[model samples]
Target: MKNDERPLIACPQCDLLMREIPLPSKGAACCCRCGATLYRNLPDSLNRSLAFSISSAILFIIVNSFPLLGINLQGNANAVTLLQAVQSLWDQGMHLVSSLTFITAIFVPALEMGLMLYLLVPIRIGLVPPGVSPIMRLLQIIKPWGMVEVFMLGILVSLVKLVQDFRIIPGVALWSFVGLTVMLAAVASSFNPRDIWAHLDKDNDGKID
Candidate 1:
């Protein structure tokens, strides 16, 4: 095999081996045998992913800091930020539940967003930082654990149940959380792991330098 030759890739769905083909700008390639999408070369994917990740980070800060819901019961008002909710659960002796909530709702999402920014920002400047491979692998591993959408659904269910007893006031953080969930999903969908690897390889091959 020559150094200039494009490598072959196996179809994810059917395991059919074929030479990788370059996709037109903003186009996708499909597997000939399985008719499954092989890869996509989305135009400006890096910029878009970076934008979404940054937006997610900002929303995450708001979600953790501001009150998610405010309740006025008999003229007494109480509100809870996302972190406070987790702490409240722990204070109520639900240690395991609180830990899970903290991990899924806070830690995983923050880490994922941070990693995306760290990776994408440098790559956009034509630089591949060290540990790109392992970091990317860790990103993939933790992607499903973030669970922002699941947390939102849980909040909605809780709000429905509590509406009968209390005056439910949705806070700014609640809306920010909703936007953060959408941004995170968009970042994940728009980012292609293969694209990053290909770009890194191309850079190393002196193609981009």
Candidate 2:
């Protein structure tokens, strides 16, 4: 098999087998028999998501700078940012959970956003992305780490627990975080891994071998 060669992937919607096409492009090659659109090209969607990702990255930085939650009791108020929350846990010697949360919630999202921007922007400008194959691999690794939805669920649970005892005020940073979570999922879904791999076959001669 050639490097860019992709076998047919069966569409669950119509049971029509579709061939994978090259990436950094848009729209789906529909099934001629059933007229079912097997897969839609999501590069455009990814562009929108990428824009939000950049904005969210900035907001995320600000969110970390300030407090995520504030607790008031006995005429004393205490607020803590997300990093502070993790650090507090670490200070309490819950090193494992702290490390996991730090990696998943902070590092992963940042890495995903950075990698996406690095590859996508160049491709958008009609340039073959640099280091195509390795970037493709990076995308594969980052895909699982884009767990914004899971993190959001955890945040909701934490919020529920906090609201029981204190008057919780949602900040701009919090809303941005929520938006960022939703956008992250959008970006992930918008990415078509096969398409990215197609771009890696630089010579455009069909056969990589």
Candidate 3:
């Protein structure tokens, strides 16, 4: 293998080996053998991630605002939102878990979304925003942390446990979470950072002529 050769990465899902092909600019490559996709192109993957992040953020607010489920135990009833669960953990002396939940579910996704919109919208107009490269790098770092589905899994598990103790009733927040998850998947599908940049570069060159 020469130093100039790109190394092949294996698919974690299927154990298929694949090489990275050079896209016109920087973009994701696909598995030659199994057609599985590899690598996300563009710092703007942050932007595509933002599409879901924004919706997830709004859903996060709603998930916190209202109770996720209600329970009836011997005619006594109680309801709790996702945030209430975190607060309960803190009240019960589980500070570390609460902090982790808050940061992963709330802070990281919000930061990723806000930074992406700040960068991409300006680039769409053909002006490189100040600190563009640094911001792009930041977007790449934050992209993986926007795990709304993981949070949803936690919610589902909580609901299952609550049902054993009381009559668990789902609320609007639950539905919102479902929608948020779908939207996040959609956002991921719509964004191909390499594709967007290739078009952007084409447009930029057109203007120079």
Best by lDDT: 1
Residue 116 error for model 3, in Å?
A: 3.1
TM-score of each: 0.81, 0.66, 0.58
Q: Which stretches of candidate 1 lie over 4 Å from their true place?
A: 1-5, 71-76, 155-168, 206-209
Look at candidate 3 and tell me the lDDT of residue 150: 68
lDDT of each residue in 93-201, candidate 1, tens digit only:
7687667667777877888888998899889898877788789889878766655667755654554463442333477887888888899888877888877876788
Please give, for residues 93-129, the per-residue lDDT of candidate 3 as tens digits: 7687667666765565457556766756666666656
**Tens-digit lDDT track of model 2 for 1-209:** 56457767677667876666654466566676777766676655545655766766676677677666565545677777767666756776768766766777777777877877787677656566657668778777766656765775575455446344333348866776677777777676666665554553543544332
Please, what is the whole-model Cα lDDT of each candidate in the order they appear? 0.76, 0.65, 0.61
Instruction: List runs of model 2 lying over 4 Å from the truth.
Output: 1-39, 71-76, 155-169, 195-209
> Lowest-lDDT window of 10 residues in candidate 2?
200-209
In angstroms, what RMSD does candidate 2 have relative to the true structure?
5.9
Model 3 gets an lDDT of 0.61
Best by TM-score: 1
Model 2 lDDT on a 0 to 1 scale: 0.65
Candidate 3: 10-residue stretch with minimal lDDT: 159-168
For model 3, which pairs clash? Answer: none
